[model samples]
Target: MALTVPRLLAARAEAEPAHIAISQGADTLDLAAWQARTQAIAAGLRAAGIRPGERVGLLYGPRDWIAYACSYTGVLAAGAVAVPMSVRSAPAELAYMLEHCDARALVYGPAAKPPDVPVELCWGPERISALPEAEPIPGPRPGDAAQILYTSGTTGRPKGVVAAHANLTHGARLNPPLRALAHSRHFLHAFPIGTNAAQTMLFNALTAHAGMLATARFVPEHFARLIERHAVGTVFVVPAMAIELLRSGALERHDVSSVALFGSTAAALPPTVAAELAAAMPHATLVNYYTSTEAAPTQTSMVFHPARPAALGRAAAGGTLRVCDEAGRPCPAGVVGEVWMRGAGIPRSYLDDPETTRHVFRGGWTRMGDVGYLDAAGYLFLVDREGDVIKSGADKVSTIAVEAALHEHPEIVQAAVLGLPDPVLGMTPVAVLVATRELRLAEVRAFLAARLAGHEQPSRIVHVDELPRNAGGKVVKHRLRELFDAAPDPRT
Candidate 1:
């Protein structure tokens, strides 16, 4: 049978009726119960006037196990597209999304209130008394819009990237070696379900017959305790959480041997950080995927190859990747250019943003605005984001490359590099570092001198206890620039 999200759940319900399907601390639900709850929620959504092709926004906390799965399946079962909005989204931003998507209904939890929409439903652990188990709707075609994920809005206001059912399902079928070896029976997710990583995790788990463990937020101590308490086999984490787990010594204290697969996304995984995690959790395989929210996940590195830290592995299943110049022609191997992807798994367009959609989803190929190159062996090497490139004295330096170099130093725990306004150079690269131990600017400069060209080195280095990061592990460069502007100049 062709695999669809709801169909996968239904098959699991019959095949593994008694098997655990989801767990959160002390709470657990088997496949039978999970399917029933999802069906009931689907009926409720249909009753609430949700129709096929209409957008339904889900603004809820992470830990409500029943609601989380039911909400996702409910939208699909009702034949409506699910738009999972983060609980952390500002009210204005939420309002704009609701208006932009023309969302017909909203399902929210206690933490997030629905915007002024005609239909709103509140859900929690308590089962809805009136909801009935509804029949699953006919499976959607491959090209139907399955989800609309919002980007970080780094360049401008966020645009909703519309992903088709085929785009999501294709990735779901290709079982990565890490997940397969771990026998990932339980998926522990700390990231928000609204994001691409969370969505991918849920889809993959359901298809693999794995239970999902949800958490409201990431608290190092709490997360470690939960991992130990529940024999969670798979965990989806970000770089910030990985750094904290290493720094807090939580991994040493917790018995997380059941955690066999450790996957990271949304940011670059520094080689130093990956090494630390490998040392701490010798039983687990560390995997990192590099992709934008716009294109879904393009490439993934399931194993650490020290010689190729920048490679995002080969293209994911059903996808083709090409690094092309501004004219859309493929560049030579080892040369940097914008990454382009074409496949059944690529998104159709951006919701309600025709101009942006036309620019990105041009002629069936999704243009990922990241500048990167492919090696001779077919491994992808990401240089930096197109917008984040720093131009210094006729040279364009990748901020990510400089940050990755800084992170390799033993004393530096985390690093973020950004462009600073410079009169002499169009923009100069400045490194902001979070030090694990005492570090000096001179020592940092000397360390980079050997690894990087003179122009790629940062003109100034600042040490801070921590760098600002969003929930997805991406450095908020906008906030970093603001902080830099607010600081009193040491030169003065």
Candidate 2:
């Protein structure tokens, strides 16, 4: 069995040389071709004076997924840590990540516009491919740091989450090896190259029997068309894409009946939206995956069930899940608390922030920073992020609950709940949504009256064409607060 990425590539190349490993549009790399590319890149990096254990920044666009994947594996093959970065990020953000990791070199694609970072070496795909192929120094081990993936940084600056080779491979070393979505022949995902979710897809390409397919970027129409064109059997999406697919009526226009396994990740899929997706793709099995950058490879997955729409599944991949109080003691069943996950893989930590590392990675468990509860049957149900809970007057309102309630309304396609300042009630819940048509505040409230309490209901409603999201498709709630600030205060 392959214990590291380099070994995994060699094994796959030897076993399935001509099998397509990854594809993007007309570009496809077979296992043998991918291995050759990585070998050339690894030799090139070594010839460029990049030493073992050095960090190398991989800057690429979404369309540059093939190059980025080669760079990542090649860096590992050369016994260096790969810091995956997105060209979509601002120059300053990219520079910060490169400097944070003390990158020794940078590998960029043709389309990727990298910032002015002072690294020892900067090479593009053409330069790396031109290098003579040679064997790389074998030194990277299962416990060695493999990659540094930055968090979405919705609340603050992005923090790099460092993962070891073992953490990334999960159970690749085991006998009868545990592969990702082994049942399918092809899986499709539109996640950007820099995110943890996208990294998981890359791993799937290396380990799974399925060929991985990605878009140049995520366009709802293009996304649906790819599924139909490729007859993609397993498809992965974030909640935002799922909502857009439903909103744009893309699935209706395309024949997506070939999708047998539909997976949603990055955030909790709203139950109402999940139900709608199930109806649209009746042939596919809908699964929701819940995990954070810090607690990766260890996640909870729930198959959509009408009876338990809110449950986020139980601990998966032999991981432990707990809801703990302020002091870190596990809360009893049905009580809301901070969610934490612990898997067999090595615990990941922040790159430079020791304070945050200590706070988030404690005793082999990564604090998920989510407030949720576990039922008697061990199913997990998230209420809200610990910071997102609205403290209105003496009551606390879950933004997730209010958003879920808002989604139930046929007129609303997407909704985000946030707290805006109120003189009388500390902070009041406000709903910013994308609706099919103009909706009266009275009708929305009348609809929510049966579903939510007085404090839980939004004090005001703001209609928008779309919700502000980071590249990973997570709703940036802080941006939503700005919308409330611009509008005049409305009566509740």
Report the number of the highest-TM-score candidate: 2
C-alpha lDDT values of all predictions: 0.75, 0.88
Error of 1 at 36 (Å): 1.5
Model 2: CA > 4 A from native:
174-179
Error of 2 at 153 (Å): 0.4
Positional deviation of residue 425's Cα in model 2 after best superposition, in angstroms: 1.1
What's the residue-level lDDT of 477 in candidate 1?
Answer: 78
Per residue, candidate 2 scores C-alpha lDDT tens digits across 1-492 of 327778778877887799888898799989887888888788878878888889999988888888788888999998899999876688999999999899999989988887997999999877876877666467588888899998898999999999988788777743345566776778999998888899989988888889899887788899999888888899999988898899899999999999999999988888999999999999999999999989998999999999998789998988999999999999999998999999877889888789989999998899999999999998999999989999999999999999999989988989999998889999999999899998877889999999999889888888999898887888889988888777776573
lDDT of 2 at 14: 83
lDDT of 1 by residue, 161-193 (tens): 887776676655433334343376677778776
Residue 218, candidate 1: Cα error in Å is: 2.0
Task: State the TM-score for model 1.
Answer: 0.90
Q: After superposition, how far is residue 180 of candidate 1 from its true place, in Å?
A: 4.8
